[model samples]
Target: MNTQLQVKNNTNELHHILTRLENESTRKEDLIIPARNLMFHEDGFIYDRSSNKIDGYVLNEWATGQFAQKTNIPSKYFRQCPPELKAVNANHWIKELSSDEDWMLRTMRSRDGSPGVVRGIMSDKYVPFDDIEILNILDDVLAKFNKDYEIEMWNRGDTGCHLRVTFPDLTTSVGKLTNGAPDIHRVGFHMMNSEVGKSSIRITPMVYRMICTNGLMGWDTNGDVFQQRHIYLNHDEISNRVTGAIGKALKLGDNMINDLLKAKETEIENPYDVIDQIAKDNKYSQKLTGIIHESFDRERGNTAFHVVQALTLASQTLNADSRTEMERKASQVLNKLVVGL
Candidate 1:
């Protein structure tokens, strides 16, 4: 006999036996229960808890016949009556076999769905500039600043140069200063999450908006736009507008405005710092920052919503390059957050 064929035949035999059990279950009203239970003891059979014909002997027999034909197995094994068949109940066999099969299937499915890397795109648009010109300008800027960086330009798509600068690992100390001002453009370096501790930084879609608006208005800096606005030169007004816009975009509470502002102010150096400070400042009051921190601590995981919110706040506050970096980082983190969940 062919080995493979023999294995196939053995499988068919098991299937046929199961089918016979099903058929026998349908032959007698009282015996239907025991027959159904016997059928459940075999592999590849699911108990239909919703079915009301558990006492239908003829139906059970028909089902068993179908199952035996499908599996290509003989029914004699199932029909055999053991010496202690009445003592060894069918329900006992069913409970054990069904549990094992259920567990095996669950394990197989779980192994198949493990998390993996996620990818996303980050895009930003800026004023039309000659690729060579932007490249030269970027080279000069990096050189003048005594930094190591590279620039690449694309002329056809967004009508602007695409510059990518590689920076050294960013520390909490560096990120702390980022909150105070837009340092990336001048510094040629920015912070991102690292496996060591902090989060990674990458370009985000907000970079496009920032670039388009700035390019349209001919402003070198986002702060320039704020300065040009004909508003009362009061910290409260500026802070409120900045915080409110970001809060709305992020879907955070009004009280979180300060923490968001502070995070933006510090250039998103340390999110934990912002959370800690907000918690301290709002010790006697309601603050979103504290709530978020507590929630994160409780879950021991990050949420896409919070990451997106942070990206929005960063866009509102950071300079073009830094904003782009934050967006990229947020995108990267968002993927992990989604997969982890």
Candidate 2:
């Protein structure tokens, strides 16, 4: 079966996948600094040294929130403070309250409105298990997946990434295609990671629609195929864990197929209601909620499968992290209706 490239994320189109990842790896600079050495400046965080100060380390949204939490202050209140007040609050807390242990500040060169952005602040023990390194480990597990599997979809951004690869031999038929052919859904994996402390490295099952290039990633009641936080894990241990996880994912293909088949048969009396509720319950932004409605209208299918497909289709244009979240939510919608699959 030919793998369909969804949206603009084809691996070949990206010049070279590993090269792109290597570029990301190069842009990062991780520093381990004592909490007491930290201070906040106007619109940035500072490394306060009397003789030689490093002040360009601006806190990105995530890092700012983290810093606020660390200082025992609410992020909203912290951001609203005057520049001098912010510094005072930050310095006072860092000096008086913080422990002596070193903290890791994950930073990137200033870009996209963030100047020398500290994307994450974590304990010094936080392992730097980023995407490039993890994929290298997978190379050993799946023979680099060069001969059999293909990287059909890719989403990359400063926040995180989701890589979707297709498994040709593990497809199952579901629904009907636009060309009067059986709709084929293939089993695959959605490898997700966050270098900026957004999420743990995770592998979830993927359901890809060959007909319309729609794909949804999800966790069943069983959860991810693999999930490991970037903490206290040595290289050898993570490698062993990844090898076992991928092996298990390949063998466990039937659940996703069964779910899609059931979704195809299950009709929703009111998709909009369900969609609206799910989006609201999940605290989806107004923009994302609108996308789902538009996708549903365009697809014009009444079955639960169609609703899920609409969500996945809508997700195609989102940023990597948002797309992953949207697809995960779509899968939950399908799962809620026909669970055992």
Candidate 3:
């Protein structure tokens, strides 16, 4: 999926991330960096004092990713080079390729205090939408649902931020579990936002599988996808859309449930052949394909639903980004594999 997942989807884990963001919101600083005068180092970059910026921030993985993309360098390959070489190449490209454009580097205070991680990097026009604000608005709207809903999960980090909420009372049964109990899916909405261009602010329908804790997002199937770009967002408009999103998503949840039921019945005679095809079509590495193959074996169900189950089950163990990607792939495959789809 284009939307990268985040670590540990729980209220407490994300609350910690939120606390950090809150602290940064008050102490955060933004600087306009001119590529020509930015000096690259092994772990961070320095902005020349002439630009009226006297400090530079330590580069975290997120910051490195931003720098790599702006300079058109693969982060893995760039990091593999010797420090001296990395600095030279980074500076060269930063000057040659991005000199004409200015980048806003957002930073938070470090433990020892001088300046810390690069929280965000973007152009001057990137709008600053505080994660705390988004969550507060979302919480208010969710309370109006009045259905004993639970904030299912949350993700807040430099990479991106996300929120998922589900109503336990709002669930539907699909196939049978191994113990013969019905497989239940609960409906809710998945929300994501990234002020630094990690992702657009979006609200979409979500289906959560109770059996394996798998999530399927972006399946409104019958309503508007409320996605607002950071460049232009009205808080009131977003609140209205988010309120409407949950109701619309719940109403259409049955449509997705029916589709999933059909997919469960649609058998895949040659699962290996299908798996191979997906790997090739998506250009997934042999290593990743092998893992999926193993997961499929573990699932041992000869239907398209099993294929999706394997992917999501595997995702629970993967890193944040990889897990999101696997979930997205599973959703896509399920859509394509459904009968009469």
lDDT of 1 by residue, 39-63 (tens): 3323322333435432111112323
Cα lDDT tens digits, model 3, 1-341, are 12233343444544565575576577667777665666766654555635657356566667777888888888898867777788888888876765578778777666576656676678777877767767767767766866656566665556676676777787888878877899888877677777567777767677788767787754423433666777776788878987886677776555667778987889999988998898899787888788878889977689988887777776777655556656766777877888433
List ranges where model 2 is wrong by over 4 Å: 1-15, 23-27, 41-45, 50-56, 80-85, 109-116, 144-147, 285-287
Global Cα lDDT for candidate 3: 0.71
lDDT of each: 0.28, 0.75, 0.71
- After TM-score superposition, the amount by which residue 335's alpha carbon in candidate 2 deviates from its true location, in angstroms, is 2.5
Error of 3 at 243 (Å): 2.2
Candidate with top lDDT is: 2
Off by over 4 Å in 1: 1-129, 150-158, 169-341
Model 2, C-alpha of 209: deviation from truth (Å): 1.6
lDDT of 2 at 219: 69
How well does candidate 1 match the true structure in TM-score terms? Answer: 0.21
Q: Where in model 3 is the C-alpha error above 4 Å?
A: 1-20, 33-37, 41-45, 51-54, 71-78, 81-100, 220-224
| Tens-place lDDT digits, model 2, residues 1-341 | 01123443333443366676687667678888777877667554576554233466777677878889877888999888887888888888887764666788887775475556678888888888887887777666666444366676766665677777777777778867656788888877778887767889998877778877777776667888889887886888888888777666665555767777878788899889988888899887898889889988887688888788888988877766777787887887887877834
* Every model's TM-score: 0.21, 0.82, 0.82
Per-prediction tally of clashes: 25, 1, 0
